[model samples]
Target: MSLHSVFERLAARPWLAAFVFGAASALALPPVYALPVLLLTIPGLLTLLGRAKGWRQAAWIGAWFGFGHQLVGLYWVTHAILTDVAKWFWLVPLAAPGLALPMGLYSILPALVAWRLAPGWPRVLGFAGAWVLAELLRGWAFTGFPWNLMGTAWAFAPLPMQPAALIGAFGLSFFTILLAGLPLLGARRAFGTGGAILAVWMGYGAWRLQGLPPQGTGAQLVLVQGNVRQDLKWDPSHRAAIFQRYVALTSQGAAAAVAEHPEAPVLVVWPETASPFLLAQDPEAIRIATEALPPRGLLLAGTVRAEWGPDGRANALANSLVVLDADGQRHGLYDKSYLVPFGEFMPFGGLLPIRLAAGGMDFSAGPGPSTLPLPGGLPAPGPLICYEVIFPGEVVGAERPGWLLNVTNDAWFGNSAGPYQHLASARMRAVEEGLPMVRAAQTGISAVFDRAGREVARLGLGETGVLRAELPAAGPPTLFGRWGRWIPGGILILSLAVALLLGWRRPSQV
Candidate 1:
């Protein structure tokens, strides 16, 4: 049989081809960035949708594809559950698929909409638009989990990433899907249009990066990577050793950073929950954490903050980033508002039988995003703890901060693509806001990116090291920065509108 016959045969199977093609599409995303593969997978998915018997079958095909896509992208989640396998052993296999099941539901709307459109341009546009709409919905629905967005596929480097400065990541997703599906009907003009648009897209990005490299902000950063294992991070017996490891690394990192840039103000950053003890509740923990700070230097350490009740018990807990000075005086505190579902708090708490988070109590969330001033004349930064950096257009607040700080614990998914994907999201945010982003991840992939999404320095996964780099000066506000989600939302709306109009004018026979 020819290639067409084989593909048709595979598409005939309700579950096989759609799921395989969907899983294949994830290869276009970060760490694996096989972008050209989208030409085959997306067109193949449209073909599968075209072969569906009806709207319900189309939805099911889309859902199966989504399930495969998300299953591969989220397979690393199983590593987290395996950390305490004794309690979650049975859940190890279910973790990725469990999350993929619900995420798969988001693809249904796009499939249904595409089912209504003509097989040529209308189906392509409608599918891409409705797909982004579903992505947007999942981004905010149920407190949002916007991972592996189609736009992030361009995050392999700084050049292709510049468009994010204009239209943001979601906007990039719109065009990415639109272009990738242009040849679904084997139209000659569609092939040429796709090529020309891609050329323009890349050429524009190149032009945007042509200027001089960004200048330094006269501030230096020391990102401390403890390389702590997830299982040992919270152990009572290993608590003292873990705290000591961070203290030692901090002192060494601070000393070296000050020596490199003596005049510049040094800022030491510890990854999320690096301190084994509760720094907010323990005075001695604060003292030890600040001991390594250079004169006029500051520290941003992630730790659990507690609200102690009068009954000698904690009423609430917050995953927080606490800033401190060398004198053991606290400077500022930013509590994490975007808590991870199940990892930090169980969704519909009482309805669930078991708790996925470490403790019995779910973490209390902080007020939404805020920009805070820093001490020592350093630039003020917006803090995004853990997975909060994954959410595009939601990283900043009313007042744009000078820089972005992300503290996370990627050790939960050791040696996996999860940490690298997380780093890519941080890079996209830097480009979108035209601001530098400093990310400190426990165990690996701690990196610094300039305003234009250029990588400045990095420490690979499972490494114990401190990266010292001067903070790059923030660039001018970007189009996306000024308008936020409006640009992408507008693109999504216009694409869908045109698709619907075309479908009305020329009805499709599926």
Candidate 2:
């Protein structure tokens, strides 16, 4: 068939096109296709939005595409549902789809924006601006989900992607869409337009890579994945076993580090909730843990913390990370600021039946980002527990850190792509902040990524192992790290302004 005939046939069923696009987008994630999936989605989304019959039609197309995108990309929701079979039927309809449905709304924003600004402005530019605007909203609206943005697919690629340091991931998303949308313009015989879009993207990426220097070097670190089962992670009966596993893992990591670099201090990292029993409450456990660490090393591990209110109302349970020095003394504690909905804490407290679930909790959110002071007054390290890593611009604050330490327990999602996807998100933050990241996850994908988002070393998902590597030193402060979301927010505002000005000049043209 002719190219024109194929385009006509594909245009006939926008919903089908959307489903394929959504599924293809999910395939961009790890353990399947790598970064190339990003190149596909850009053209796919642009074609769907560009071919829409009207604004209403565009909305429908965007919504279904968003739905399909979320439905497939977030299939890990089924793992949480499987935890409680009693609520399986109800939860699948209520919680599972509800999660994807709201997230899917983000896709509609791009469709609307693209449809409104289409067929006039360069399709590549218009699509890029609209897609970035939608992604920005996805990160901001309703506390945001910035998980798996198109830019994240490049997490494993060799490219430094430090451009995210200047414009943040949302900006990178815009560039990706622009490159992808160029093909759509090419399909319409707009060769010069397509070539220009591709050139600009490659040129900007190349320039950014050259500008950002490598951050750190040769500091030995160990990431311990304890392999704790989700069902037993919080159970009282398994506390001792959990402690033993982490201790064993830490010991193994320390041994590996010693063999590789005898002179360097071993910085052993344990995943979130590596200790089922509260370290603050259990002195014996703390004593046992301290003794397990090397005399001249640092052990950072996650634990639950409880503080009683003056009036004694249930107090507050905090998900937190504690830093232990070589002397086994607690140096500092970093509480998790961004808690996971339902998993870490129940939203609205008693308003929903979610409390009846087995794994739900009432943990309190921690205070905003703060630095954890290292011995000898080196630049403090930024700490994020679990879901906190998903938020792009917020991870590092006004003060940049030597590196980012993310502690997560991915056991909840089992042996699925969830862990890999989570690791990808964590890697993106390293790129976004221009800071190397040390990630410790329970039951899988424990690894270290450089500021460029390249995986320096990693233990595969579902593997029971310890990752021992040396973290690179801190690079110059990233623009996103220093300024947070301001840069991306400005881009969105400017794009909107340009779209509005053009619309005003030619009111009936779109």
Candidate 3:
């Protein structure tokens, strides 16, 4: 049997083939990280597109492929719904497919465009270009959810990921799609070129790693991981316990730091919305928090800040990170800027059937990609609240911070791949910005990563512990930081140029 016949039979049932291929490719993401699967899946997808009867069929094929990819890659989204099974149980069946359908549309449109542009390697590059554009568009459209992007496949392994410093995640994603599809040509020429590209990809990564200086010392940080259960978190009864847990952890960190460096100021970090009380409105919460802070120590915690209207109602509420001195006075506040559409505030929210973040008024977005002035007014730390850490160039603004602080509430996703995937994005941001990051997550996976994207210290998922570490040093400005999306933009243009110049010929149906 020839390769043509094998794929012909496989492509005979396009949806099934695409589903399986896309699902297998998802293993390349965090937790499983079966990176080699990309080589198999991309070619299989190209085969389906090549065999499609029309552009519409090609679009559907790609949509099914993405559906399968996102269905498994984002299984954790179901975990959030499971948190409140009673009210959300009905959504359980619809959640996976519903979200997958729209997200998959991103892939479909791209494949449709690629299919129109002749065939052969042009089709291949077209596929790569379309797919990456889809990923980029998905992130931008609908307030952007760039979760489980193909480039994230390299997060666990540092070598292939090193180029992220120069090109950013989207640039890496471009190369990932292009190289993966090259093998579909099934010729010695194709194989040789693909192999050489892979070698260079790795060679560049290795060179970047070698160029890094020996890991140096970092700043002192106390990261609090309050293993708060999402189901119990919002309940009125559990609010007291949740508040106390954060306070206790903050105090514990202070005690440890006092013994080690009594005179130094230790930075304390808490995950997203760790505090349930309206922090600005409540005096009792402040009293308890103040009592926990050690002298010269600064506490940075996630809490809700309500700005009351003159009519004695909350004019606006922000999911904010508040900085407090030993006296618990509000030193600084960085409200989350990039709010999750459905999670934070729904899109066409009033018309929608679902509304997240407890049934209340929409939470106002803050002016973010902003810097936070430290307690004694230090160089300041860039604040990335919750999912905001996932964005690459957007993380840093005009005024660069000395370090990065990402506070998130991943407990909503439970003990799943979500936290790990989230961590991967944070690490990539650190590398791109050339700044150290302090990630404090509610319910574990709290960690510190250096500017080189190496883990300096960490606390595991589902465990309740305080991660004590020296906040790693920042490297010089990165290529991605200086240039931003221009690098990937250029790659997209070049790929299109080559595909056009090479000429498009119908790829072999087999």
Clashes of each: 0, 5, 2
* lDDT by residue (tens digit), candidate 3, 263-346: 667788888888888765588888887688787777788888889888998878889988887877887888888987667777
Q: Give per-residue CA lDDT, model 1, range 1-510, as digits (tens).
A: 898887878876967888988899999998999988888888888877777778789898889889988998888988888788999899987888999999988988888788777788888998888888998998999999999999999999999899999999998898888888987757786778887887989898888888637779988899999999998888899999999999999999999988878877889999999888888668999998888889968989999998989998999999999989998888899899998877778889568655655787889999978887897667898999999998888999999899999999999887888998889999999999999999999998999999999999999999998999999888888999999888888988898899888873323465
lDDT of 2 at 148: 73
Model 1 RMSD in Å is 1.5
Lowest summed lDDT over 10 consecutive residues: which window, candidate 2?
A: 501-510
RMSD of each predicted structure: 1.5, 3.2, 2.5
Pairwise TM-score winner, candidates 2 and 3: 3
> Highest lDDT, which number?
1
Judged by TM-score, which candidate is best?
Answer: 1
Q: Which segments of candidate 1 are over 4 A away from where they belong?
A: 185-187, 505-510
The TM-score measured for candidate 1 stands at 0.97
Q: How many residue-pair clashes does candidate 2 contain?
A: 5
